[model samples]
Target chain A: MSLELAVLDWFFEPLQFAFMQRSLAVAIMVGIICSVVGSYLMVQRLALLGDAISHSVLPGLAIAFLLGVNIFVGAFIAGVISTVIIGWIHTRSPIKEDAAMGIVFSAFFALGITLITTIQKDNKIDLNHFLFGNILGVTVGDVRDTAIIAALVLMAVFLLYKELLFYSFDPLGAQAGGLPTGLLNAGLMVLIALTVVASMKVVGVILVLSLLIAPGATAYLLVPRLHQVMLLGAAIGVLSSVSGMYLSYYVNLPSGPAIVMVVSALFALSFLFSPRHGVLVGPRRGRPWQKLRTLLPSKGS
Target chain B: MATSPKIIVDHLSVNYRDVQALRNVNLTVRPGKMVGIFGPNGAGKSTLIKAMLGLMPVVTGRVTYGDDTLAHQLDRVAYVPQRSQIDWTFPATVWDVVMMGRVKKTGWFNRFSASSRQLATAALERVGMLEFRDRPIGALSGGQQQRVFLARALAQEAEIFCFDEPFVGVDQKTETVLFNIFRELAQAGKIVMVINHDLGESITNFDQLILLNKELIAAGPRDWVLTRDNMTRAYGGHVGFFGHVA
Candidate 1:
């Protein structure tokens, strides 16, 4: 009976602090939106684009701080700009999309680091918090901002679900069928940018990719349909976020990395145990050992 | 049902970077006929269709259906890109893909109606893929995948149909199923155009042929387009005379 009470106390203690409440709210909102939008990236094989957009937002955030504007607005603009530049470079030249992404992201990331480091020397900003999120430091306003972004992103995804599915699955066919693929592509970029901006306070730039990709990918192994993947992924993301927050409170770990580690651990568990696609218990589970043995010469030889 | 329009291409040209992929191409496709666009590798067979549908930038002229530009009337058209262009591993069941056909007709921000669901089901049945409706697209064989796309086009209920390389890696059963549906669509007075690279037995299935090699070599009935001189012009001097060789 005492042990049960202690467990309950461990869970309830964090709710006492207003800062913890804000952080948990922000984490949950970020968790839901990131995975829902990230399912599109996973299905389209555009995971790197998520990374590019996340890194590109740093310069925008820094610039917004300098100009006294909402940092999310600045981050969104920078993310959109990076995508346009990447598209321009890929379409106008022979450089492939991946190379364009790599070039644009690294350049933007470097510029962001330089700008943030310079500002940090004079201002009270901590570069570490920006690179690896400061979830515990999120304020009530930040929670509200995340909620608005989350609502907008989720609404857009819901309304555009069918179009996005068609466009991402077969772009040329969708274009040929008279779907405005260019508009769809741009709208998708906007959704991705909003998601990345909303996520920055919870996972930071460097670790955001795991939050954006791992949940959806893990759900992909378990679900057969796109909407199912999104649903399951959002659930997984929310559970991980809340549990990671409690783990951080109890074990004295950084909240952002702890959340990421929890999400990664969940992905690993799915990777090894999913019924249809798992590495350890799937259809061809034992065949690898047999194949490996076949590679060796027999005793007669 | 709306009457299918007569397709007219007037002096169409296409360029990729510095090279002219298609030059001074012209053709006329009337309703109630299966038109096959055949060419060798890099012959711009796909480019011609893409340019006509406004999928690619046209360099010279325009494509029209009856009184309207093809681009403006795209809602009445159904197109299937090459199978290789699609990501089969995408997380969608066959039912989900077939429902995509109803997306345009259901309009933006509107849910698919019950009639739309019935149409999708009928299309799946038409292609003999009703049993696999719930299966993931990636798990199907190449032939089954092609049939699913064909079912999607059928569900669109469009007046014009365009297929790019529908027979590349499909089995004989799928080819026969596809050709039967193409013939039915043509018989119903819908314009049917298919991009084909093979000069095999399937060549005889088309009612009209548009033989091309960067430019229009021949565009007419099958017998006229498959002439020795036209074959040599399109395939570049490596012709062995076949059954209808000129």
Candidate 2:
């Protein structure tokens, strides 16, 4: 078989089905949106904020499921509410930001799990589906929801780009400048929550945090400019999603973990070989003198 | 300069958990005055400034700027926090940092109108940092970073400015430059409140002094406030650390 024919066969065979097509579109959109905002989050040292929001959204999702409303709305609402609580706790309490996040995240996630177990004891919903996304099971509604959420996320990022940057870099400075630092910080948390909800369909809850942080951090190590870092991160995110989808399709692996693995691999490659500052390169040639000595002849003198 | 006092603090106090950082601190900064709030370590110097600037949440008593409370007058005042407290590696150019100062003066939504950016650039030029405008803040030396922050505060065009330990970690030459800038601002009729540790230098450079050691020691002209009695009260045992007048 020709190489072109084999490549064509893989795409056409699986993607001809509606669910696969929906999954690909949602994944790609989620990738682009999350990465752009995630770059800012990483730069601001709010990388773990995603994990906090992700876990916090569980109760919201659980309540929404019980009430039969759209789960995305519940997740978005819960994410924002939890973030606000965390911000409040960070200020009123002596605990730092990370500690506050830990307090809220664990408690909320445990509550969500308890609610799920207690509420749906008989023939419970597939927790695996939420924890690890199943591309083969995505519906058209999921794709549409992803597109709307992605657009909203992009708009928010654009609107608050400057203020967000200012707040992220210097909260006290931003506050003194009358930038409404609290509202902007809250806005960031909201943006993060929105990003999390948008990503839930593509990467699922269990692997969402990895995608939010890894690609953006990898881009950060490679690029110095803020805009360039954001652009590169988004590109990396999209590539990871596409390659991960393909790898999962072929290897019969779970799609969500596959995407995270691909993103992790990208980060590893970036760590070892990025032209800007690759770890594997020699000091002179990005290698040890001992290795260089092997290439040179021994001198008797 | 306006006849009204640029800053007023009444019965101000701050408690950092069990320790009281400030106790019943009161102060008044008139326009065109370069006032130095001087004290030894743990002297509540920073707390006084933080309370005035509303940075400390647990501040008690009242702080007013001109006719209104300082909180309401946030736009009319600018604060330059200590350099050591900030994240220098923040992904912002000198230009971006300076530009932030104008955000308050400008319209809502943190929009940078043409005039705002122009003012930012001009502020950088004033600090002799125009050449390094495009450089990231982390790449700049300690003095340059401090100057960038000063330029940011300048861009606010505020009536009152509060600085916390602007001279710490700075070279002697940079320190001189910063003081010169402070003098210029005061001469231009803006209130300059600085938290300083160099008492001898403060006596020479500042027009007024607020000597503090966890409580209000004195607040008046430097000559009257820097007396041996007040110094003894503020510094306590640390008075021996400084040589008396020859």
Task: List the RMSD of every prediction in angstroms.
Answer: 2.1, 3.8
Q: Rate the local accuracy (lDDT) of all candidates.
A: 0.91, 0.80
Candidate 1 segments whose C-alpha is farther than 4 A from its true place? A284-301, B1-3
Instruction: State the lDDT of candidate 1 residue by residue for B112-134, as single tens digits.
Output: 99999999999999999999999
User: Can you give the TM-score per candidate against the true fold?
Assistant: 0.96, 0.90
Candidate 2: docking tier: acceptable
In candidate 2, what are the lDDT values of residues B133-243, reduced to their tens digit?
888787789988888889998888887888888987877767777888899989988888898887554457888888898999989887778677788888775565345
DockQ in order? 0.86, 0.48
lDDT for each residue of candidate 1 in A208-263, tens digit (9 for 90 to 100): 98889999999999999999999999999998899989888989988889999999
Error of 2 at B114 (Å): 2.5
Error of 2 at B58 (Å): 4.4
Model 1, residue B142: what's the lDDT?
97
Tell me how many clashing residue pairs each candidate has: 0, 6
Docking class of 1: high
TM-score: model 1, chain A: 0.94
Residues forming the 10-long window of minimal summed lDDT in candidate 1 chain B: B237-246
